[model samples]
Target: MNLFGYEIRRKSNNTASNLPASTLSYIGVPPVFQGSTETVGTIDTRGKAGQAKAYALCSPLMSVISKKCAAIKNLRLAATTEDGEDLERPDAVRTMSHPNGVQGIADFVAHIEAMTQIFGKAYIVRMESVGLPEAFELFVVPNLCVTENAAISPALSFMPDADIVDYTVTICGSSMKIAKEDMFIVRDASYDLNACGGNISRMVSLQKPVNTFVASYEAVHELMINRGMLAIISLTSGSGDIIRDARLPETESEKNNIQQAFRKYGIRADQFKYAITSMNAAVSPVSSTITDLGLTDVQKACKKEIADIYQVPSVLLDVEGSTYANAKEAKTILYNDAIIPEANNIFSVLNRIYGFEDFKVMPYYDHLELFQESKREQAAGMTNLVNALNNAVSGGLMTTEQAKTELLKYIV
Candidate 1:
């Protein structure tokens, strides 16, 4: 079903406190670099631009990174006991399934998409009434809520009397001013001293690699355009000579006649040729032999660098020469190294917010077919261990209870 049929507004009737922006003066955070919006992919030979422009310029870089993040977002989530045992989800967690036909996971994924797009900084403002947060809305921080082309002041205002924060500042174009308990923020924590906490977007570490990747592609495109434009070299008897026809014109009046001569005669037609001669000038067209740019090698290296940042293998990005076996191995590495770790990071923050002491929420993907091989290997290893324990018990090396006790370690 299409959810974009009409405008969706928050159902909460909470009003923004008529607080002044000056009250939140001390609560400051560094904003993302906001120069004029630029495009990197456009035909420009200048050096690599900033992160925002790189995203606009490099298609593959954006695809691979966003795809990885989205994969994490779409992974199935489950509530589990502290012991890592799956449990029935509580009503509080199940609040994601709104009666308004919006899926909680979908809304959450949308925010995550924004987060990954902007160096992994995402703010989710939860709307609450009577001390319970009911709904969530995402806002782009440091990038929006502009005043006179400059980013607005702090979006967060503190209310000491209520002991809760008032998030009543406009973000981007959204005007939200909910209580502190109702809002939850997640950031990548760049560790900049100027920014509040270590949550500022990492200026150097995050963007440098991405810039290199973008620059590599931009260089390749520029080279291709240069090759196309300078392919033909004109050799003339005199400097004043100009070749001016679909085939070479006899007079200066035919200067504008240059067009697609190859279409009229055909490519490499030695028998169908034209000659140009004048009182003191003659002209000949020579196709320059352009050297190969080794673009394939450069692209592979750039792609590998990108995969390294995401902890994913180049094979998963469909890097050339990847075999099926290596791709599968790469997928395993990606799941264990990148996706699961990211899932843990996301769930850890959420679990802290949910304040579940005895239980924790986690993304569960044991059901995914891609991970089945790992599970199968684990199961087989466990079965072998159990059999060995059984043999030990039968051989009187250990008692049945002792074997059971030993097996519990492996099971847990």
Candidate 2:
């Protein structure tokens, strides 16, 4: 099958028996290894979208970041003048409220944010009617049925410097080509020059922390499954030789007796307790306590690193010592540093696609509590400034023009 301009062949059950000599030579399979049952792993050449999606699904920290970034759903689209005054929503912009008939704008933005966070790029096909876009369809990333081709005609390119000509999207065995002009792409930074500098996925750069988180999660899972065992019990003779025959209970009666003894003398519900084993068994700790292992510490560190990469605050992920003040501050930082910037980036591309001549489409966040708090603070500050300016002018300490200039400084 052709994937990202490469043909990948699947190994059949018969292997060498079904293949011709020329085909085997072309694949560079050695004669001795051709029929061998050893299976070789194949690398995914398209990108790390699959791996990133898997990480986002399995890793709790990654999932938190994904959900936090999905706050883009809170943003409302509006048409705004150059001076930042809100204008009436345009007919074309209103279509975004229900991008497709199946989902509302909240769900649409959530999916877009999640995809952009995981895959570093998102494709939205503009379904048009009479040279105007009526709806948009979001394509799933890392889809095997999707293929992006380079522009065939220089004059017909979507963007002057963009190389992508069109996207071939196949769904449910049906395929269609979406031209560049009809597709809106939101992408992250890329360092490569090929294929319009293929987007650099955030998850690709977070492999280290994500792996650390996975390893820690697995370790905790195993510990839980083993009932938090910290030591290994072994039957040994006085001379330090292991008594293999006595290591395990021989009968059901013996097993019950051992369990009874442990319950009676071993660590129990009592706060202070000791184990008095009648048998000559040695207790050697094969693993340390969770504290000694620093499992929580390592996992917390990994979580913080992952959150930082996604521009999410650790406090928002329920980190310890999260005060009300700090949590509110973190929310402000989240909107300012992450969510709003991401929305701006996405809508910047959308504005161009919608091609509105009078006003541009932008994200409105004034309804958000964080922004509301900002407005309240501004109002309080402005009131105090006006009162002070009036007092100064009435007291003859400053002229009216000077006071007006001071007020302008504050307002502007």
Candidate 3:
């Protein structure tokens, strides 16, 4: 079906809440200093200096949904899938750098607000990391806390009588402009696929020139809020799609800096054993990825997932009157017995799996609906696809004559 016929507004009898500013505040990198520890990564460099690398990271800002008492009973985190049930333990790690070459934080935030269509008011965080390396390096300094320019406040969408977000949104310098729209179900995204209005698409597409867009509530603490880690708690009331473009220097430079920095920093061939290794960070990877692919008894899967979160191996999950309070208490027991003690015993092992020990407890995140294509990614994909197809044929995966046929099959 063609996408152009979609209308943005659907008339209603009630009034809408005035939307807030879209570009709330800006997040800035913490200033570098002479004594801070350097975070290095995995690449061996040709020994260069002064290359600028910038990336955005994200973390989940968790809070109880529907209440602020530090607890929400039976806060459903589990879901059933073909494979099994996903025991709802939302364990948030920091956002990894995105391969799409996405840069500025503003563009990142816009992508997130549009995602309310699927995940309802959940916990999230967005962050950006900028490095000025003559050669890319990944080095971490302990006790370093960075800050951002702005933060989104506790705002949820609500129509006069409606409880959910069914409207399209455009956020500009601290203002949120909303328009009504028609939508249809999409098997992929958690919410119905939002067919864009001419205005929404254009507005979303405009973010490339900038970074990501985020919330206004981050300023509750210091002027330079914790860039070390971030959390997003959105009460969007189901805000619909706001589009985003894929092209921007922000995306490319961030990755280039990280990849190159590590190469440049590592292979120095000396003893800094605990001296410093490489550090890799960037925007999170979001594709039309339905990962944790293919399983049976998704409910069982959920059970396992919760077990992993609590670090309570199945042998330990007492099925004795398993209530949520019991679940919470059980997790606490696991945390104290296995999780905490194990954490101390396997510090290095934890760092290897969890980015860094710090990241496991706290980090940053980029909040967005996962399946839609950002303009930047959409365009970059084309050039790469051509090269990929040619390489496939050269490797004898297909005949030269069959290359075009093979390529077409993958593009759509």
Candidate number of the best lDDT: 2
Q: Between the candidate structures 2 and 3, which one is better when assessed by TM-score?
A: 2
Off by over 4 Å in 1: 1-50, 96-103, 113-117, 129-181, 189-197, 200-203, 206-291
Indicate whether candidate 2 or candidate 3 has the larger lDDT: 2
- Kindly list the per-residue Cα lDDT of model 2 for residues 6-88, writing each as its tens digit: 56689687876676755543112223223333322121223654454445444654566566656778877787787878788
TM per prediction: 0.64, 0.74, 0.15
Regions more than 4 Å wrong, model 3: 1-30, 33-56, 61-412
Model 1, residue 60: distance off in Å is: 2.7
385 in model 2: Cα distance from truth in Å?
Answer: 1.4
| Candidate lDDT values, in order | 0.52, 0.65, 0.28
**Residue 313 in candidate 3, Cα distance off native in Å:** 18
Clashing pairs in 1: 41-57, 145-172, 167-177, 168-177
In candidate 3, what are the lDDT values of residues 1-412, reduced to their tens digit? 2122233465453322232333222342123211112222211111111000111210111111111111111111122232433333244212222212443222222232222111211112211245633222121111011111122452443322133243222122122222212211111112213322111111121122111111111221222333222222111223321122222234778758645643443223652212242322123322211122221233234334433433354333442347665655654554444433422222222224334332332111112122123446876887788898789888998787787876677664
lDDT of candidate 1 over 243-353, digit per residue (tens): 552234566655544434423432244534443434344334332322354546656677777666656677777776788788778777777776676667666766676
- C-alpha lDDT (0 to 100) for residue 163 of candidate 3: 30
Model 1 scores a TM of 0.64
